[model samples]
Target: MDPIRTDVDAPFGRIADLIALNARQSPDRLALADAQDSIGYAALDALMDRVAAGLQRDGVVHGDAIAICAASSVAYAAVFLGALRAGVAVAPLAPGSTPASLARMMRDADARLLFTDAAAAEVIGAPGEDAITRIALDASAAGQALADWLPPPGTRPFPVDVQPASAFNIIYSSGTTGEPKGIVQGHGMRWAHVQRGARYGYGPDTVTLLSTPLYSNTTLVVFFPTLAFGGCVVLMPKFDAAGYLQIAQARGVTHTMLVPVQYQRLMAHPAFDAHDLSRFQYKFSTSAPFNAALKADVLQRWPGGLIEFYGMTEGGGTVILEAHLHPTKLHTVGQPAPGSDIRLIDEEGREVPPGEAGEVVGHSSGMMTGYHRQPAKTREAEWFAPDGKRFIRTGDIGRFDDEGFLTLFDRKKDMIISGGFNIYPSDLETVLRAHPGVADVAVVGAPSVQWGETPEGYVVRRDGHAVDAAELLAWANAQLGKTQRLARLHFIDELPRSAIGKVLKRELRELNPS
Candidate 1:
């Protein structure tokens, strides 16, 4: 049975059809916006047709995969939608990655064409991977410009059947080093996401500002929904606190998806309050741990509903924290979303009792099919029940409270085992963050001489607030349990993060491993 129609008896309507409907209804309505350009619904819809026609004219067939490695732009978005119209899978890769890694990913996804821009082409080092052809979104002299590559404006793609299990897009995992895993999400899973647009008040009037990289699911989750529902999406190629505030006010943005770190930065910005963001109807955050204190500050100051989404790109049981309604439950990631079956399991894969922290595994209608072309790794990511139902392993250690709200305890791999006791690094980091001088902090487990593994703290101090590493470590340990005490603490200028603002804990562990 299909999950996208939302109602069990309702016929599934394609998101592309909805876009076409939107175009027919409101041709002049703004559909997409970027720093350099903005396109109305009718023009954007027509552009997609041109893109699809060009792909077909170039011998690209249905079920084949193409890639887009450029930063977010109107052209990038057009090509993506165009590929879907042609029943072709898309692999949206990150331009921030090394050339070798990006090339390797294109090969892995079996991408025959790479839609890129001048900046991204430079990063990919000439796009010299296999027989892949390159088309420049920014019209660089090095490759075929998007304008020239696209078919005539009136051209339309031939119709193709897009079934529930048809491939949608391949989102590469955020592995800073080495070959990243490509998560294959299908059209059905994406349609479910689009169906959820109504919950966030998405419509023709909804304007969303997406500052995160397009490659990250954190950005696409909001991007697809806004466009599908005839809303305008404002893209930010690079995230800047001042620029974001400016865009929000200028665009009259009603919705946005930001990681916790982006929120922290926005909240810390001196001019954040000065911005006129009264149009915001909803603000969504995911992809990293959100501090309760920060959520409180946003609720107190920002005008809109703040929702925290807890789930992975692989799609499993989802938890949604509606901070506006449940003020007291801000510390937790809220209860499982409707129809989301979230459960906890012990080390041996046995289901854990309520209130006990364990690895999170979930089953949902929106879960991914599996990792692309990696059957062994895909099986490793799945957990089967005694009844033979499949669930995705979240790799996050968490617990369900009496009310079913989940409180995460860092990643399962990040959890430290010291003297046969579990030590969650987030627990240690939370305590350390309470210090007045700490601007930011991350705790990672290090190899230990006696305890096998021990917690080590890396900190970024508030400017002009003096606190020695020894003093901060001693203070933190005094507040922590005996087994949870830190083994060492070091001060740093900043905590390293990925493009989407996830803390690089592995880098910290490697840097200070005991």
Candidate 2:
């Protein structure tokens, strides 16, 4: 495959520059929508330009990290793009994040300016004792407040000849260790991913529903595809089952990506079947693996609407499950995307054969800039292949079938070995979730005096439905091998999730405490 290349001088030096170019090409086209309000490409471009001017007037300059704490709104987008236009890097903090979390992240990132809306202001507060400039968007006037808040003239624009490797934003991962690590994304990585998304039928005519929170890297992948195509992004203030369907129908949204849990909730809503989704062209899902039954259910109901793509936040890694393979090879996360490479290797670092599970390694031009200064961890993740190609170890385990399709069986870090038998939680959970009464389920290992460790199934029931533990146990035991069957079960209202909606098995294990 040819190496990824970026067109820096064609327009804006970075992804933000695409906004101005789109404004000129399709000025009157709707660029973004939030609830009932919408903005055309020209209006959004002009508004973001003003924000850039204002930031310049306030002494915000290139290379500075400005913290933006606000809900997903056009104003938030303006501040994000404006900071970039002024050559400043942005650290978009979750609006309602706790003080300690916010403080630690701000300190770690060395953010010098803070921007927030009123509600988040109450939680995050102004940059009081901290060495940072403060800017607040009055939620009372909506996002238009930025337009009237003028900047003095002659604000210098960033030099157009900047390097493509320049830092654009500092995003933190949901650290399993309780302290997040900052992930530095460069202009080159951003453009590469944007172009990859464009190849998936995203363009000027596309309309995407921003169902996930903007702070999520997943949202960046979804929303920016539309932006790259000069298409409209319909942003919801927050996710609600009915609200999503209503917006999709109302705005004629063609594409969306949601967690399986969100899709389940949407299907549970009374108005779900009432909405007309025939216009829906593409519906992709990730953040957690979905059961084959769920894929079959969607395909049987929506025909050609569903596509599954697997990705990780760490290395900009992605694998798109082709629509043609769904329900046929339902266990796989599809094949590697264009301009990418994937391999499954064993402990001795040799490539594994078909149907044998091994660690998944990948290479992409869009990977982060070595997890923002953690040289040791970055070096550990990156290694040169025998063919002189570099690949990042994804920390995931999978296998390839005879047909060359990929099947993700487990996370290498999440595997459980019980009584000398290796067991994958995903293999068990996929079967458990197929039970009609089980709405969602997660499988983990629980300590046992006899077996050392046994599989535990944490299940959430469907609304107004109940499952007898022993009866379900009998059903699972009869179908699964003795070692793979659930040794215990617990009912819960909802499973704990990270912001991006992945099941937090670590928390589940902690709570159960064997």
Tens-digit per-residue lDDT, 1-514, candidate 1: 3222243223344577667777888999999999999999899889888888888898887888999988898888888988988888899999988988888899899997888888888888854335588888888864788888888779988888988788889999999433689999988888777766668888888999999988899998899889887889999998889999999999899999999999999999999999999999999999999999999999999999999999999997688999999999998999898878999999899998767988999998788988999999899999999999899999999988888889998898888999999898998988988888998999888887788998888999998899988888889999999999998898999999998888988888778655
Q: CA lDDT, every prediction?
A: 0.87, 0.74
Candidate 1 Cα misplacement greater than 4 A, ranges = 1-11, 127-129, 176-178
Decoy 2 TM-score against native: 0.91
**64-141 per-residue lDDT for model 2 (tens digits):** 677877788876776787677767777888765687788888887788767767787677654555446556565442
Q: Each model's TM-score?
A: 0.97, 0.91
Clash count, one per candidate: 0, 0
CA shift of 23, model 2, Å: 1.0
lDDT of residue 464 for candidate 2: 75
Where does the lowest 10-residue lDDT sum fall in candidate 2?
1-10
Candidate 2: which stretches are off by over 4 Å?
1-13, 125-127, 140-160, 324-327
Task: Give the true-structure RMSD of model 1.
Answer: 2.4
